[model samples]
Target chain A: MGKLYVIGIGPGSIENMTLRAKEAIEKSDIIVGYTKYVDLIKTLAKGKEIFSTGMKGEEERCKEALRLSKDNIVSIISTGDAGIYGMAGLILELKDGEDVEVIPGITASSAAASVLGAPIMHDNCNISLSDLMTPYELIKKRIEMAAEGDFVISLYNPKSKGRPHYLRESLETIKKYRAGNTPVAVVKHALRDGQDVKLFNLDSFDDSQVDMMCIVIIGNSQSYIKQGEFITPRGYKL
Target chain B: MGKLYVIGIGPGSIENMTLRAKEAIEKSDIIVGYTKYVDLIKTLAKGKEIFSTGMKGEEERCKEALRLSKDNIVSIISTGDAGIYGMAGLILELKDGEDVEVIPGITASSAAASVLGAPIMHDNCNISLSDLMTPYELIKKRIEMAAEGDFVISLYNPKSKGRPHYLRESLETIKKYRAGNTPVAVVKHALRDGQDVKLFNLDSFDDSQVDMMCIVIIGNSQSYIKQGEFITPRGYKL
Candidate 1:
């Protein structure tokens, strides 16, 4: 049986792709991803079969990738770290095969954290507010727990147009347990097109500044914004 | 003023390095990092002046990297995602100028998390038990709270020759909150030389199986062992 490589391409940029990701992309006989991502890989992938789909069609794409991997080398690409909010969970759910190797990438939250500064340094937890398949009540409960535990929290899928008003509600939920002065940053389309990072306190945010692709990082009670940088000290220092 | 790129090279393997990391390393006139990490960039850094120092000498290294960036193109290399346990924090501490760019890399914990299955999916946090700078008391408190919150925890610097009993003590503390059957995986030199990923549970482990380079991930109450994979569901799918 041929092997399957589930790769994280790292936020849509060719530069952010690891050598292994590049090699996997180059060597794979078939590449499967969303149509937009397939277009992104067009230049690197020549004379190979390409399977593309639309948004929310990831399951279908993974199934195809698995079917192809039975006969030839196949790769499924996810933007940023493949495990965090990537195809990893879906693929694992399918339990396609034991030969599946999940190649991790720089997660969008990690990249955004790097760019936005260290609000997640100490005790941090990442939670997505998408509620697409997961219910909102569960997300709120998790957020409350993270806040109560004083965790520097990372929020993925914070906003969107059709799903627009979720961030405000999420912020309200966060504010219930966290102080209003808690540091919040909207890292929009990180490392991708239209990349913009904004540092602001949750209490002072302008709701007009975010969209779906943005990853919002909210610091714990201990998190502070220093000179446009959001930092949560890990409690260990020289 | 020349630009300073804080690039994350991901975990140990060169294949895990992003294309942007390679470009930054190539374009840099001066490469600053620990000697071991400087070695990681040696192949692509043919004409660059490499500035290296011993471990625990990071403050001086950061100052030198900053000083050189005033007149030259300089890049600081960190083994994992430069943000997570990387040199990006120290660089931000200096905050020399406004022209610094942070490029993210794959973090070791997440990479290990991927290899060990879903041990770090959600409702989790990462803590490093080096205690070189952090007090043991604080580490204990955080572990307790993490356990209380049911966090799937990733531990860095679990056991060194100098601190052979740290992991054992940690295991005791973790047992206070987590069940004996809680899954744990010690990934020694993950993706690096002599890499070995050992999977077990709290009830089955001893201190002899770990090292300083090993990253030990302890699962929460919800974590389980199946098919040789330590699984922690994010609860997103439900």
Candidate 2:
């Protein structure tokens, strides 16, 4: 007979949190998130108990959050809009007669795309390059399909510490359908103070420059870079 | 050598405005937007000269804002994310050696999608239904293709005084590829104070209930209505 709130905190900024999300977090008796996120909002955890865990501890995090929610108000935070590539799915898998609510936040991909000048204007698609659980072949297939479909591909999990070459591999797979001169945008730490954005041509971008916190948007054939802006036309003839 | 800021203020709240957007608006010498949006943030326009217009006056609004930027800091406001079906395109058409900076905000479709519990999770697409200038037949063809591809369709400008039955017509067209029981969600004044959300089966929704301020999301075959929440899978394996 308890309530659970699943909230997307919008990138890494506290100001990005919605009024409703702030109220939910304030009302919650316990807060659960990754150790980094919990540490990020230390000031908000004034008197509330904090449950923190390391990476890949998602399943355990959900179980503990749900168990504690039986008698207390609990909130689980996701970095971006919760539903897209966030904790919403995992929490749904663990739902057991609990009162749950999802408060959406500004998603990083869209935010990044916005700052980069409408890279996802129309006929765009997003594909993640992690391949942590999904096979590399499937990711390659999706990349091919996205390229053929002329989607402005938003690449999430582009690169990580141990898996540094994933972006290069994915780029290679996309080369068949996409021209090397296509425009690509890299947004790092979007909306979190030290935000950095760079525009690169597919043929010249150094794969070594990418990091996990970045979201890369690769433009389609028709996409153009005009005066440093990345634009993918929506096929509208206005 | 003046600067022009095209800021997307996100859904419909002051809090939804990014810190960067607030800074731009505060530092701006002139603010330009549609009347309703201008009314939304009159406080931000305290001493600045405000230029407001009606729908279909986008070109004029942008031109005036752009003209002012040649000598003063100017900003054009787009309600949702400016790049997605907003002023980014129009601004691009009018760019003339002016330093144009795009400050992205949250889009209404994503906000509505979040409220409806992820109707656009994994492999979904969004298309606007407003054909104010485009022919109805073209919009109809897009709807057919969307339905055939099983993409979650987000209909904007679905209904208004002169186009009251457009949504009804589009629904009938979608029936060719979708079943009568496909889930549909209507979100009015999304993220605003007086937000109203309604759930309906595709075949059972009342056409007269829709209006311009609403966004209708039609789910794909995998979409389901559970406890008044629309759930769409993003292909995350359990």
Candidate 3:
């Protein structure tokens, strides 16, 4: 007879978390998530019954959270917005979603955009390069279409050990529509410890700097670098 | 010189705002924003110098915030994530992009997604139908491309008194790629007072249910409603 809460903890720091996200973690009897995400919020989860799993154990983690929610107030945490490539869907699917509440948080793209100076000030699309659950071909098609439409593109899970070539291929697909001078940026661990943000051009950005922990932003046709910050105008007359 | 903080307040409630956003408001000597957005956080702005403008006064508002920041710490508030179709770009443009801090908050799309279950649990695109700053042709093209890419599409500023036909026209564009039975949702004032979440079929949803304040989500081809919540699977083996 207890409720389940799927919480989006934003980026790592306690300061970046919403009041409700913190409240959800405080009010819960147990916490669950990927090991790294749980470690990120271990400060808030102090003294709470914690459950965690490795990278590929999302299914087991969600199922465990759902089972526990049947009897106790359990929280399943996902970094960034829980609904965006996060664990909200899995929890809602596993449990008939009877008593689940989703607490929204700042997404990685927005966090990166803030650091890069509003690179996504216009219409935008978020595409993940992880080919685990989604096919590479479908993700590539989305990249091409977003470029063709001139949408500000945010790339998540850009590269990992398993998918080494997907990020480069996705960039090649984007190069067809965007100019060589279009601004690109890599924000590693945005709002978290050791956050690093660097800007590059569409044709010259070094891919070696990107990894699974980074969120890459490729500006649209109108995006540019001004005073060292990547910016995209919202159809403003400059 | 004082610094300018462009803060996103999330949907509307203080509980939804990040700790950084709250800290920014508390540290600001003056607060500047649209009249309604400023009203949403007036409790925090109490006894502080508050300057607000009506709609269509964004340019004037940005200039005023910059002018005041020369001698006072200013926090310019946006209701959602400030970088997306928000005031971040305008402020960055008006100033020389110096000594400004951006505090990201939960965007309206994420807020709406939370209320609508997990409708955007996959790759997605956010498009605004407002043509005041952007040309109608460009907005329409983005809609077509997002639909063609099979992305979960989120529409903001869907309808206004002046742009009454844009939402319907945009829906028609989406219908060409998405099936008529694809799940769609309209979330009005998400996370705020008078919040409403409604799910409908792509072909049957009423356009009158949407307005400038509502965020409409058109699910991808694979989306469906379950347990009365609009749910989109993340390629999980159901």
On DockQ, the leading prediction is 3
Candidate scoring better on TM-score of 1 and 2 = 1
Docking class of predicted structure 2: acceptable
Tell me which of candidates 2 and 3 scores higher on TM-score.
3
**Global lDDT of each model?**
0.78, 0.76, 0.91
DockQ of 1: 0.45
Per-residue lDDT for B19-72 in model 1, tens only? 888888888899999998888667877778988899987888888888888888
Ranking by DockQ: 3, 1, 2
Judge candidate 2 at residue A102 and give its lDDT: 78
User: Would you list the clashing residue pairs of candidate 2?
Assistant: none
Residues B143-228, model 2: lDDT tens digits: 66566656577787778887777788888878887889999899998877788899998888886678889999888776787667
List DockQ, one per candidate, in order. 0.45, 0.27, 0.90
lDDT assessment of candidate 3: 0.91
> Across all candidates, what is each one's fraction of true contacts kept?
0.44, 0.22, 0.89
Which 10 consecutive positions of candidate 1 chain A have the poorest summed lDDT?
A89-98
Runs in model 1 with CA error above 4 Å? A96-98, A132-137, A160-166, A169-179, A233-238, B161-166, B169-179, B220-222, B233-238
Give residue B36's lDDT in candidate 2 (0 to 100). Answer: 93
What is candidate 1's CA lDDT for residue A47?
Answer: 90
Which pairs of residues clash in candidate 1, taking residues 3 or more apart in a chain or in different chains? A15-B20
Better of 1 and 3 by DockQ: 3
Q: Give the per-residue Cα lDDT of candidate 3 at B43.
A: 91
List TM-score per model, in order.
Answer: 0.90, 0.82, 0.98
